[model samples]
Target: MTENSNMQSDLQKDKKFQRDPHFISWQWPIVVLAAGCLLYYLIHISDHSLPKEVTIHEAIENTNLFSSERSRNTLRKLTKLGPRLAGSIQNEVHAPALIEHEVQEAQSNAHSSQSILLQRQKGSGAYFLGFKLGFTNIYDNIQNVLALLEGSDGNHSILINCHYDTVAASEGASDDGITCAVMLELLRVLSMQTLRLKHNVIFLFNGAEETPLQGAHMFLKHEWAKKARIHVTVGAAGSADVNFSSADACDRFVRRFHGRLVAACRLSVTVSN
Candidate 1:
């Protein structure tokens, strides 16, 4: 009886050893990783969430607001013209004409308190790209289509820039055409009689960006650049590339712009919900 009891006790110890092994288990690590991922997703997912879409009919009824459908239509028209390379007829002539037409259409509906001024600037200049490039880029008759919306106080201005030119063998719809379309839509919205502005706004549709920024250089030589307090260059959708002469100026503008954007986004989200 004592021998049998000792054997049974040894077997129970073996079973216990099998149940609780000394080796590390992967299950707990996997569970921890999954929990961490879930926590991260819950924390940061809102940044990736999209806003409610606006339909074409809703956009048309609300003429004073921005319309993605209208912008998309404009993009379609611009892209239908095909590639608009620098110095080409499509870039220098046709694109400018289309932009001018759009500006004129916006101007017709502009508020009585606002004045829209359009300029087709022609300029020639040479500038050193950098020591890395080790060459000077020269350009002549680089076209820039500029539209200025004079606000109640026109002493200071904000410049929004986008290029309409593309490289050879590419349609350049996403590269810049969409940005131009968005600018057109913004101009329309800002010109509404219901809205009031404290400072003037300039929309620059540069034609020589694919030529490596010659249009922007030409704009610096223009008298209008003097009044420009802020410069926002839109390379693509959601790209808010800003350039300023001073760090302090950029900081101030960024702070104000960020605050306004956050407020607007919150309002949109609340209204959608």
Candidate 2:
């Protein structure tokens, strides 16, 4: 009887201890502080925060700069033409004409120091996918719209490539039309008097990528291909691939380009704010 009573007493004491207000009071402050810290971290320290929305006036002012509005407009215009499959009228004739017009406009407005040369290249080639696949693709009269921006050192150049063609039944706005619009904007910006280049830049708007890289293969046979020391391919379906002659050159170019991109993003954010 005595032992059972002692056990009951102990149980009651433990229950009291478990329910102690002081213990909870001490823990509550700490938990609140932790939650507050988490909220602060999420709101201020994280890069995942949404960007501030830009007003119409701010967008209009930034048109001379890399403008999202203008890019979207260009994309809309391209996508409206429908799927530009390789060998289709949209891909071969209409798309090339539109891109050529844009490049020509940029060339006309280019700075005196910069000389923009536009080329509509037609060529034929065969590409073997791989030994394992044993697939050979042949192309005839594949068109490539190339714009060369001559710099001080014209002997060496960098090639920026993106295909304008898309798979059949797809609008391809995101797959390549957006990228084409971006390239157009980049050409316009680089042609400004304020910017000067040491090595030439060639923008290649390939028309037969859906035909499995036929346009690029055709470009390899072109005279301009000899001057290309580096290749930068931007595709939505894949990551950006930069190919350079040397690892050191690749590292230097990546670092420089990344820094400039970050700076541009910050500047855009500031302007929007």
Candidate 3:
């Protein structure tokens, strides 16, 4: 009876093995795919890292002397909001609150100086024309934060815009969180400048940019856009080239700078010549 039981047990074990799929074998393919994905990610990140050839001056143009410690502070504040996707909870509630606070603080600073004329709208609820994002059935909502450093000459206004929204999965520390922080720093610096500006500079922090550039499209509908002689947009993940569509416009802008060429990384500016 003992021997018969032992043989029966062996037979049951063999049947179990036959019924089970090769789970260990299946794991090997998954492991290979994971490894391939990791390798690809590393390669891509290395390629898009900040360019080594970029100079201090070029970096300054992007960072504005790192805004003397305020750069990191503003960046930290924005990153604390985490991924700000349009219609997400962060986008709907937290991001706007934080941005409103920051803008109020910056505006207070802007108001401190009697030398410059400044006007700001803390939260402008502008609706962008809705469109589906990529393969997803998501529609964009426009939420733009605008401030104008109104120059003495209002005949020609320059619009400087940047998107503050991040993609669905990213922390957006680099994507546009940095841009927002830089804009704050720029606002701070420009406010402190004693020299009078030649043209009005509109500071626009746009939303819904991660989805189909809805914020930008809607920006064109603004009355200020019609009066803008120059439009400067600050958003390029890791590019350094300053692309000018028209050489004549570039020349005129350079001349306006009084022969000072400020190297801008990933900055595109359009000016009517």
- My TM-score estimates for the predictions, one after another, are 0.71, 0.68, 0.57
- For TM-score, candidate 1 versus 2, the one ahead is 1
| Quality of model 3 by C-alpha lDDT | 0.64
Clashing residue pairs, backbone N/CA/C < 3 A, model 2? none
lDDT by residue for model 1 (1-273), tens: 999999999999888878555677889889999999998997677645656556557766776667787788888888878889888888888889999999999889776766789999998999988758578999987889999988788899999999999878777777888889999989988886565688999999988987788999899998889999878887643324432223673576567666467555531111100
Worst ten in a row by lDDT for model 3: 264-273
Ranking by lDDT: 1, 2, 3
Query: CA lDDT, every prediction?
Result: 0.81, 0.79, 0.64
How well is each residue in 7-104 modelled by candidate 2, as lDDT tens digits? 99999988877865545667888999999999989768545554644443564455346655656677777888898988899998989999999899
What lDDT would candidate 2 get against the real structure? Answer: 0.79
Best-first order by TM-score: 1, 2, 3
Q: Name the top TM-score candidate.
A: 1
**Model 1 CA deviation exceeding 4 Å by range:** 1-49, 131-133, 237-273
